[model samples]
Target: MRLEELMNEHYDEFNENDLHILKYVLNHKATSSQMSINQLAEACHTSRSSVHRLTKKLNFAGYSEFKVFLKWESQPAEQESRHTEILTNDIEATMKNLADTNFELLSNKLVSARRIFIYGSGTAQLTCATEAQRLFAVVNTFVTIIHDQVEFETMFPSMSDEDIIIIVSLSGDTPALLPQARKLNAKGIEFISITNLKNNKLAQLSPAAIYVTSSPTATEKGAGLASFIPFHIAIETLIRHFAEYLNV
Candidate 1:
């Protein structure tokens, strides 16, 4: 959560001095990262100790850690200002990430599976359904999408070692989907994931995952769901390679 939200959530917990320090830090968020502890204390008309205490209240180790949050909050504006530069850099970085990905391994997995099941939710489901349908049409692959826990569990009796599951999540922290991922893990059913570049839970849990360079300019919200283009590209890459292996 952002510091502003944090402050609002725990508004009553802070004393007047604490509120002063928090207001100063939040008001000067763009430059707060550069401000020294003493400077912040002086600006807030509080002592360094009060500033230190305020950081602790915010769950940061100290002013330094708090400043890091400030810096992160400030970065998006500067990044967005250089739109063309950011786009070029992100594309170049994404290309490098894609180049480093082992598509051959993914292709091999698909080739060996008797059935392919795709799992995605919300915006991601669109990618899953489209790719599943495309692969089925072009190569006659037996592909299906699992939309919910009920559907997934319903198919579990039919799923076997010869089958493969693919889960796509930008954050890899989908609350409803993670339990199912874990259950599949226990049954020794390996799966693939397409997620963010981070070492997210879904990426670590899956046997294989495709990483995409993190960029959010594409989304109206500029959040986790922002990079559909990257996911779309990665999905298409796998489909194209899988089709080639099937000689379709």
Candidate 2:
């Protein structure tokens, strides 16, 4: 249970003395964990019995357990901050890589394609739709963005040489995209991929790859910190170049 939940659940049960102790705990929870029962009592301007009573009121076995809980509750924010720092550094590196990749050449390819089909599975599909709308709004071209893998592949037979497909995947190893890339390759369809800057199969199969490098340093945070930032920025960057190429 979270410390906040405990306080809310038993807020009414606390007496005036307990309230005084709680105020000290809330204000100094980080430092409170290191302090002894006597130290806490002194800080709260209360007696040891009052400190013991407050811990009991909060349903803790004793002061030690309460302090342990406080310490544990404070750790996630620090870990999250470290995870955020790693992502920031990765973003800088990804931007540098983007700068070195001749986006003008990419723009020429986009401008020449007769039809653009953007396919993104899972979370990245949202960016595909939004970016598709943005591209169409600016370039005023023939474009389609399908979030579903089956729906996108259904149009494969009808796909022509003039058509170009763009794949957006966070992991760059999507099961759904594997077969789709094979289909494109067999039909000699040159495609673009937006994915993590890893030695992944999707990037290897595609004619053009736009990589967004967000290192998975925060294994504890899972996919929460993984980003599609480069996908968004790359799409916008290409659209700007497409505008310049068309003079629109």
Candidate 3:
């Protein structure tokens, strides 16, 4: 069975703390794979014993074995190599990736969010705004894509526990967004980050994050080549999921 299937099967066994650890593990398995049990405990704000118990409850022999399973589940499959290549060079391929990722993001968001705020900067900011507007039209959901630091700051005071923030940054290292993200966390607002850099500050701050592989760094005077296909894919996936949730 798939990891998700297994998780569902054992969902009833998890308590609030267990669920918190599980959510973090699921969203961050790619980086969690590299972490030791102690490191994971530190990241999750839990104890090593809790981590061990959770892994055993999930039917893994121990933390190392669990990490291996998580690694397999989190990384892109070998088949994605072809799609990645297409994203780099072919418009058609890029469009397909966008559609797929968007569907996934929308579905997950629809299930998870009460209210949603999207934060982005540079080209990504435009993408978030467009998606937020599109989703607001379909569902009676609140979706805001904040651009400037002042605008972003002004809105946070009104957020409550039921709100979630979806932050988009290609580099996963936007310093300006960190304060807002940290503030949201302190206020019990959850986050979903769309970024290319794995295990960066943005990912560390976010309770859940999606990483998309990107091309190598650009040369001086050349257009920065961090691919936006993954971001588009995630947003499109999210919108479709949101529509389905409304229908249901």
Candidate 4:
């Protein structure tokens, strides 16, 4: 995973000091990568132990690995004109997967469930889920959207085996969602997932999953612009297939 991904996965665990240190490192990647742990702590106006703890929270083996990661991220990106072409290929592949996927089980579950709830791990993912809700509503299959953590927690206890959940997540390994996934699993609740990658925790926990392939275009500074267009395509495909299944 990239630094941004790591951060996203463990973001809820970070404190204000950790964020401050992260901001400093992000802004001074080249310089910080070469600094010793003590040096970085001094520069960030924090203690060495605090810096080490932050590295661990990011899932780095140690400060050494963290430094290596910083060094890797600081390297200049190579320009690729084929980025657009690659994304097109990725979308085509995702569409093929969608067509080939057997959605019968999911369709049955959706049709039989007493209630259908949908949630997303982030803002963009929530937008995709909203689109899905809109599509389902077209068929009069009213789906509930869990807008945030507070709502999710409040509504979770009311969930039963007769209900089904749809989770939209980019990484599928988001920290905030893992506990909920585990709890859902323990309760034998049925849930499906839509994520960028298939081999992630959320997908593993799900009885059904839709995987979308997305390639991030790298900027000169090594930051990436990952297109979520494939997510929308997958959503539309699933909803259309379900609509056909409903013979609507």
Which residue runs does candidate 4 get wrong by more than 4 Å?
Answer: 1-80
For all candidates, the clash counts are 0, 0, 14, 0
The lDDT for every candidate, in the order shown, is 0.73, 0.74, 0.69, 0.84
Q: Write the per-residue lDDT of candidate 3 for residues 41-103, one digit (tens) a residue.
A: 999999999999988888899988898888887777444334355456434433443443435
What tens-digit string does per-residue lDDT give for candidate 2 at 1-248? 44544554466577898877877777787888889999999998889998888889889999889889889866644343576677677777677657756677777787788878888777655666567666767668767877687787678889987888888787778887888898898888878887776546677677777766666653654645466665677667666767887888
Give the Å shift of residue 173 in candidate 1: 1.1
lDDT tens digits, residue span 1-248, model 4: 45554554576688999989988987898999999999999999999999999999998899999999999978875554877886887797688767656787778888999999999888898898899999999999999999888899999999998999999888888989989988888888888888874346787667777778786678778887878899999888888878998999
Show the colliding residue pairs in model 2.
none
* Cα misplacement distance, residue 129 of candidate 1 (Å): 3.3
Better of 1 and 3 by lDDT: 1
Off by over 4 Å in 1: 1-78, 82-89, 217-225
What local lDDT score does residue 212 receive in model 1, on the 0 to 100 scale?
A: 64
Residue pairs with clashing backbones, model 1:
none
Put the candidates in lDDT order, highest first.
4, 2, 1, 3
Determine the backbone clash count of candidate 3.
14
